[model samples]
Every structure is written in structure tokens, then in C-alpha cells.
Target: MSLDDIRGIPTIELPYETIPVTEASAGIQRILSLAYMLVWMQSENLITAQLFGRSPARQLIFLMDETEAHLHPRWQRSILPAILTVLKELELIIDIQLFITTHSPLVLASVEPLFDQEKDKLFLFELNDNQVTLNEITWAKQGDVIGWLTSEVFGLKQARSQEAEQAIEAAQAWMRKDDMNQFPENLRTKEKIHQQLLKLLPGHDPFFPRWIVRMEADD
Candidate 1:
């Protein structure tokens, strides 16, 4: 068929009609692109063995960088699981190894159920004392996205805004009666810190009760 033929590029069938892969949304396009690449690899493996009288590939190594870059949070939560499912369904006659790097906590949380301590590993890139090091992290399951965000993998203190985090830290320091010099001048006093906390934290914030009880006791 000519390059412009309907079969030239992959298409998705919709309820009303078929649409070219190029017409799909960015998220869909990214997913379809990955599927096409893996399918092509499988096809090449089979073809080389049959037509060229060569041994089929014994393994495939797939490397993906920031795999969740363009994906929405909803998709990010499921994409890793879906990819693993697809890989299993492909049933290729070769072992497949996947190397993926992602910044999304949802991506890491999604794999919690599928993580194998024996077969899978987690590594962190750290900059220490002007030297860069790659450290192998012992895998531990963080129940949800928030857990992953605050876990060592992401190193987030509160998974909150910078202002809110600072306010919280200041509150914690005040409660512990720590040295006020360590905090911003505005956050050093109970009244000022309370106002800052009120402005930054929502009513339902967990930090509220702790601060409120202390404030009420001192009054």
C-alpha cells in the first residue's frame, strides 16, 4: 500500500468513525507511540528468525525517561500498571527488561502492588559533598501518592506549598520551644506565628489541633 494509505499509520476506531493516531490527544498519542514501538520490536524479532534464518532475540531492554511526563494524574496512577499488563499480554518469546524514570508519585504508588523485592530494585541519584552517587534503595511500599511524595524517594517534607511548609516548621519549633533565631523573624512569636498559620493552613489541616490546644492552654 502507498504511504498515504489507511494502513500506513496506526488508527483508533471510535463510535462514529476511525481517527488517525496523529489526531489523538497528547496523552493517547504518547501511549500509542509506546505500544507501537514495542509491537514493532516483537515483529522484528519474529521476522528475523523466520525470514532471515537468524535466531530470534533472546531479550529486549526498554528504557524510558520520565515516562509520566505528559500524562494526567489519573493516567499517571494507572499507566505503569497498564504497561506491565500489556507486557505480560505480549507474550513475547523473549525476556523483557524495563528501565523507567519518573517524577510523579502516582507512578511510583501505582507499582506498589506489583513491586518484587527480589526481581525489582529502586535506585536514587544523590549529590553529596560535591560528588554524585547512585544508591540502591531498599524497596518499601508507600500506601498512596502522599506517602510516596513524602517518602525518601521524593524527599518532600510536607507535600504542601512552600509557605505552608515554612509555617508548619515554625509552628513545630514554637511548640518545642526551640531557639527562635532559627526561624524567620515574623514566625518567631506565638501571635505572629499563629496569624501566619491561620493565613497559610486550612481549617481541616492536621496541624491546626496541635497548635490550637497549645494556644488555648497558654491563654
Candidate 2:
């Protein structure tokens, strides 16, 4: 009921309750969740054993859903590698498998530097033409988080806000048109399109030439 009662490790006492980790943030709570899950899986009780200090199996598989949940960008980057280290500790005598679903670009960018193609693969689930499809892609190193956001795994055309995304799509649609002067939303003039693109995309964007020049050339 008191910190001294639990070997000075702290505890949550009822009514006049005091949680072990007072004022802890969600990121810390995420770590505790993982630690507790490991403890329960191996010992069924938190007090019986220290969770990750020793190997619990020769071969093990871990499937994590949204491992980046509640973690900051820095933690998101380091989480997968840290989990792998723990799993490797558990799998001292054999190989291990990790399947994790994540939507964080930081998470992908973090793994980009350390992922082994021989031991790892990236599965991308894309919704296209109202149907969902899965593809296995060769692991690629996207050194920048923005690059990871635009990568096929993330399926983003632009690593910008929703308005920017809409402008880029509109520009693309305009470029695909047979007539350069035709603008569906009164973006007919070259100046209008140029200004819109400048607002939506950075100067060095790869699509700049295609949308700006090619569209003008057709006129």
C-alpha cells in the first residue's frame, strides 16, 4: 500500500490511491503497456519476474499493432529497433519474427537505416479503384521523414497539408487535360496555375516541370 511496502518500488494504493508512476505521460504509459504485456505473457503475474532482462524462449514471434501509438516522433523512430533488441534477447538460440503495423513516417524512416533486406520485407496495403490490394516491396532507405511520407508505403503524393494535396491533385488534373487553357475551377490562366502550384509545392518539387511547363507548352 506504500512505496516501502513494495520494496520502495512504489504501488497504487486504493481510495487514497497513489499510482506507481505519478504524473507519467502517455509515452511512458506506452512503454509500461509493452513491459506489462511481456511480463504477463511469460509469468502471468507482474511480480513473478522481470520482463525483458532475460531470455524467455528459444524462438518467438511478436505481432504489434500500431506500435507508434502515443509515442513521440523520437520514440517512434527508436521503438522498432528497441523491440527487436528485446526479441533477440528472448530468441538467444534461434531466429525471431516481428510483424508490426504502423502509420508513422518517422517509424519507417527510422527503420530505413537499419532494416536488413535479407531478414525484413515491407508490405504495403493500398486502396485503389475502390479495392484494397497488398504488395510486398523491396525495403528502401528513405533517409528523410518527408521522403518516407511520400514513399509508396505511405502512398502520399505530397508531404504537405490537405489543401496542398488538393492543389497538387488539381494541378495534375489540369496537366492531364488536352487543352492547356481549360480550367475546371477557373484556374485557366498560366499565372493562376503557377501561383497555385507555388503555394502547394516547393520549388524543387519533381512535378513542377510537368505541371508548369508541359501545360504551357501545349498552349
CA lDDT of every candidate: 0.87, 0.72
Task: Summarize candidate 2's per-residue lDDT along 77-187 as a digit string, tens digits.
Answer: 899888877776656545567888999988887777678888788998888899999889878787788888888778787788876676666666666664544444545
TM-score of every prediction relative to native: 0.89, 0.66
For model 2, the run of ten residues with the poorest summed lDDT: 43-52
> 86-176 in candidate 1: lDDT tens per residue?
8877655678888989889899988988999888999988999999998998899989887988999999998899988998898888888
RMSD of model 2, in Å?
Answer: 7.1
Q: How close is candidate 1 to the true structure, as a TM-score?
A: 0.89
Q: Model 1, residue 47: displacement in angstroms?
A: 1.4
Model 2, residue 48: distance off in Å is 12
